[model samples]
Target chain A: MIKVYKELNNILLVNLNIKEASLENGDAFKAEVIKLFDKYHKSIAINMSAVEYIDSSFLGSIVSVFKHLISFQADVVLVGLSKDITNLFALTRLDKVFKIYNSFDEITNQ
Target chain B: MAQLASKQFLLPNTRQSIKASVQEVLDFVINSLPAGVNTEGISFKIEVIIIELLTNGIKHAGTIETFLDVTINEDNINIDKKDFGNRFHPGNITSLLVYDVGHKELLTKDGLHSMYAVVESDTQIRFVCEEENGDEVLDVSNLMEHFGLLIITKSSDTFTYEYDVDTGLNTFSVIIDLN
Candidate 1:
């Protein structure tokens, strides 16, 4: 489950509350994000402070969501990844694809 | 050197069991580690590696049942997982991809001849492949698309695999340094 908040300039901020984003919930997570994107939230920033770890399936879901949003000319950003998760992104070279921020304030203040 | 502790479990086929297995392994690792080890980082890496390996076993092999063994000594954490499923060859990731696509040309040249190659070399060939006309190709997208094996190779200190075609047993072993 995710908490959705709207910031100025129509940036949609979604906070993921899950402890582990793995295969068990990855599909549902992707579906929920797709629903938000379908609602026309063009600029989405996911806050992943609570997510400690993610498996390939979860990462695949994120990639799927990014691909889906790209067709509609929307963009997605990720923020607040823990050290291990950040290393994962770096290992997969996804850090090049997604704009990652350190904090929600950093995303909003910019 | 005698192992400080050892534990083993039969892995269930269901994906739901993956989470439980991860937790079980984490608990064992945390409890077995000697004092002064960097528990937090090692725990995270172990979790990620275990999940990736188990998920691959379940997804690709259709392994109805398997066994996982975890052992810890003063210096290393050893993991051995065995599955009774399709014969698996730990080879160049590109070769696997080509095989998946029903192309046989690259399997012989780029692919590891056997699982022994993976262990003997102490490295799984990855991110290198050939085109149809004998041209070398490097596809970053292919590497990113198949990140599971990359994660496994990057996280573990020593990773190897063995397969018995006659018995249809795939054994993957990893040694993670605890120092």
Candidate 2:
């Protein structure tokens, strides 16, 4: 199982072990991300410091989780987005949708 | 060990040299593979898939002072190509999110850009490719400039990419069922 740690606020840090975070762990990953939404009414911060490759299914999972959180007026932020990962997000126009940060410090300050 | 697979290659340090390198290995795999498999769509698929991975590494992974390790087995294949330069930053890995299956609402008129162009099935070769009259001449050596991202996804039943920055090494693997 991938590591999921909930922080002081509604901060959810998901540390993926591999550089490529695609559909291999799609359902379980979705479930973990959604679990944060279901429990935390505060802001949700996803720390993707360890991931490198996130494919379409992985993007959908993130979007699906965001939808659930937004319904509850929650905020979501993604941290440590790599150049390649950020490019893909930008390509899909998801860069506008996601609150991406270079590091945890950038988001934690906000 | 019952599960023993190996891929030994003498990878020269130039971009042009990799074409023969990729094709030779693909040919070896094609020739040595189990028979009666339809490689119709997949035959074209290999061009995109192989080039994307190999070229990306050649272009970005930077230095070339090492060998590539490729492992093929019954279930999956593991391809590890490392240059082991000073810049292999283990901490900063590039993550890309491409969609193989599409969203009902977000369909692009140009099919190549769409990630959802693929179908879901664990079996194998569940990819969809539109009729493309591409450039007549193609060099796997210069793949990034020519090939679209869709080829990589369409070529395999499953694909994964990883590059270790600390190690300055990149690895990509594709698993397909020719049966």
TM per prediction: 0.75, 0.41
Which CAPRI tier for candidate 1?
A: acceptable
Off by over 4 Å in 2: A1-6, B1-179
C-alpha RMSD for every candidate:
6.7, 18.3
DockQ, all models:
0.36, 0.01
Of candidate 2 chain B, the 10-residue stretch with the lowest lDDT total is B138-147
Q: Which stretches of candidate 1 lie over 4 Å from their true place?
A: A70-73, B89-143
Residue pairs with backbone atoms closer than 3 Å in model 1 (clashes): none
lDDT tens digits, residue span B76-107, model 1? 99888888886565444432422332233322
TM-score, structure 1 vs. true: 0.75
* Clashes, model 1: 0
Please give, for residues A1-110, the per-residue lDDT of candidate 2 as tens digits.
44655465646655555555544565677787677567655666777768855555466577666666666777667878776567556544456566887876665577
Top of the candidates by lDDT? 1
Against the true structure, whose TM-score is highest?
1
